[model samples]
Target: MDVSKEAKESLLVLDKQDGNKVKAVSGIDDAGKLKTVPPRKEHEQDFLKIDKHSNILENFFSNFMRQVKDPTHFEFFKIKTDDVEKVAPVIETMATQKDTASQEMLNEYRVEPSDYHKEQQGYKPIDESRIDWDNLKQFGITREGLEKSNSLEPMLNYQKSPGLHRISATFDNVKVDTDARLAFRETEDGRIALAVHGVRKQPELDRPYFGNNFSAEDKHNLLTTGNLGRVLDMKLPNQEKPIPVFLSVDKLTNELVSVRADKIRIPNEIKGVTLDENQKAELRSGKAVLLDGMTAKSGKEFSAEVQVNADKRGIEFKFPENQRQTQRQENGSEFKIPQKLGGVELSDKQQNSLKDGGTIYIEGLTDRKGQQYNAYVKVNDKEQKLDFYRWNPDKAKEITPDNKSKTQVEVNSNGKTNEATKEQKEPLKQGQTQADEPQQQQNKPRGMKM
Candidate 1:
């Protein structure tokens, strides 16, 4: 009895259960055994081997799950696999068609060698024995000398040392006599000595010590000797004393004299006391005098009998010549006439004319004291009175003699006098001119006569 088919069918069920236990227990069985048990053949062992089957079920299940979860993944895997199979045929055809294609591509991509490496490949090593020691020595590079010196020897050698103080002297282009022959000396310990050569006056010099860098000329100048006498002994100059002078009283006012030594004396006549120089001579000749006690004379007191004629229309004050004194008085006198003493009279026509902006004229008027009086006219109406002088015929005629219309009286907006003339009207045209016709008639034919 053959159990191969049965065994193949039973494997799926066993794998679904304990697959590790089935793997561990599976093996070949003897031929004489019950025919129900199948023998494991060589091909069967290859198919059922656990090593070959390792992770194969896991991969297949993962692929199946991926296909079920993402349809695009399934399609992409299928298309990529098909494209790979198509690409293998294309690569094979290209390989068989050209042998140089691969060689040409490799040659085009290969990096070329560098110039420095190429030159280095042909270079020879330098010879050490041919170097000149003499030239190296000039540069202070000797082997023993360089070894003995410190590493910072050059820096130490070029370092600057401390300096000593020195005195610099300059002289103007004059020479001094040195017959006296002064000598001076100084030491580093601050010691000094001074002497004079060939001086029989005193062989031993008694001068003070001035250390090194001291000159005999400097010592002589500091000692104040010989030609430096006047420069050192000079004194400042003195200021002058102010003088006193005499001045006249008249000159004091002229500003020509400032200081006075004596009391100012004025003469009894005081001739120069005139207001100006041109009157000075006249004053001196006694033609003019300063009248200290002058007084104005008192006016005379005279009385005149005034006659006043007053009525309802007007009033007048008069002094009759017969009543006035004919003889002149010893003292001057004055008489006054009041404006209210005279009253004005207006006729009905005159009043109406004044109210209608008319002007009045008076002639041959006389005043009291038998004197001829100037004539003046005034309007009394309120509106007419304001500009009465402006509309006066005499005043208007004086201003505009050529303008006769201004002299002709006219009524104003205030019922007062006005100088403006009435505007003249323009005359009508002779025939039916455009302006003469009514507006509606203007549209009709001009051929029709008026």
Candidate 2:
């Protein structure tokens, strides 16, 4: 009784008895519209007041089926892929019960691709578990090596790893080092096999990026800072007009990353004071702006400069310490770099390297909760401060939201499965990471996309 209002096509109920032969009571007519047979003599009274646009649940359908006198009739309904989960159960109960009708209904709908889609070549996903992980031992690599370097997941998903890797292998009786990434390809024998990406000497930046032509300055900005520093209009394939995008470079791989600029929603207020249109525009343009009368997390007065950073794909604070001159970053003649961070003492050599704008891996850095974790640290020489990243920023830039690996277990690409509703005969709605249910028996339709 509770169905989505978006439901359009109702189930085509077919019932007839001809002794072991399946009698067709409804089918597609000459005009391609659904044609259902007229109700029999026993149900004529209920059909008299029913109109084409009527929702028959309240009275007509409720009373009409009980009048059928067929002793051994069977029912079948052609349900659509989307509406099956919502309307099928009601049909099942009514069709099977002896007091309701003299028959049972078998769901005839199965979830295979439509004929038009299957006629052409279709992509079939491979099960990664069937792969032989020990095959990489020849190259002195193991499954653990691929897992640690973030390459295993992509290969399992039939994609190339985002960044290149250095591995030692032998060829022509000579051992040499090679830089490459991993992928999976379907063999002629229909088995998933390992593939290695051939490397180019450099990235091909000559081609247009989403229909946006690159200038000399644009190339320079990307090469120097890894960010384009501003949004640009970019037209994607099949799109009529260009959309605004924040562009950056994956430094390790040199692949360009473009995120939709308009998707970023800036809050009306930050800390305490509301920002005007001018300040918001400055942030969107990737320019830093200083704001006063703001508050810090410790309930103290603070003021800082904030700007949009493409690498992080969000707003970041530049001079957030507290009550300090926000313009000091511009003139750091008297500013000094720290010798230690988060109470972890640095050796003189490491401190000097940080002062010289070098990145170093640091461990034993304590958080507010007293938990210690390792991090990559670099000197923000212009800001006279240190910056920390959980992963090396050079390699991490390639792991964007658009390029993230979909979790291996889920079958539906557009939507997720919910484990709470796993046993139900319904499809998952959207954004669920777990399946609606597991298939305990073979060849049973779990109502989930396989």
- TM-scores of all predicted structures: 0.11, 0.32
What stretches of model 1 exceed 4 Å from their correct place?
1-344, 364-450
Error of 2 at 127 (Å): 11
Over 311-344, each residue of candidate 2 has an lDDT whose tens digit, in order, gives 4456655564442343333223233555666569
Tens digits of lDDT, candidate 1, 1-450: 223332221111011122211111122234311111121332243232222112332333333333333212111011112133233233333333457885443232121212001122233332223334354443333435332332123212221111111111223633222222222333466433222232133211133221112245433422321111111111223525332222111110111111222211112111111133333333222122232211112222323211111110011112234422221122111221113211334456655444343455433222222222223344322111212232355455332111222222111111122222222112211111122234334444457444
Which runs in model 2 stand beyond 4 Å of their true positions?
Answer: 1-207, 223-225, 251-254, 268-274, 285-305, 317-450
Please name the candidate that would achieve the greatest TM-score relative to the true structure: 2
- 120 in model 1: Cα distance from truth in Å? 99
Backbone clash total for model 1 is 2
Clashing pairs in 1: 186-212, 315-343
Question: Residue 376 of model 1: what lDDT?
Answer: 33
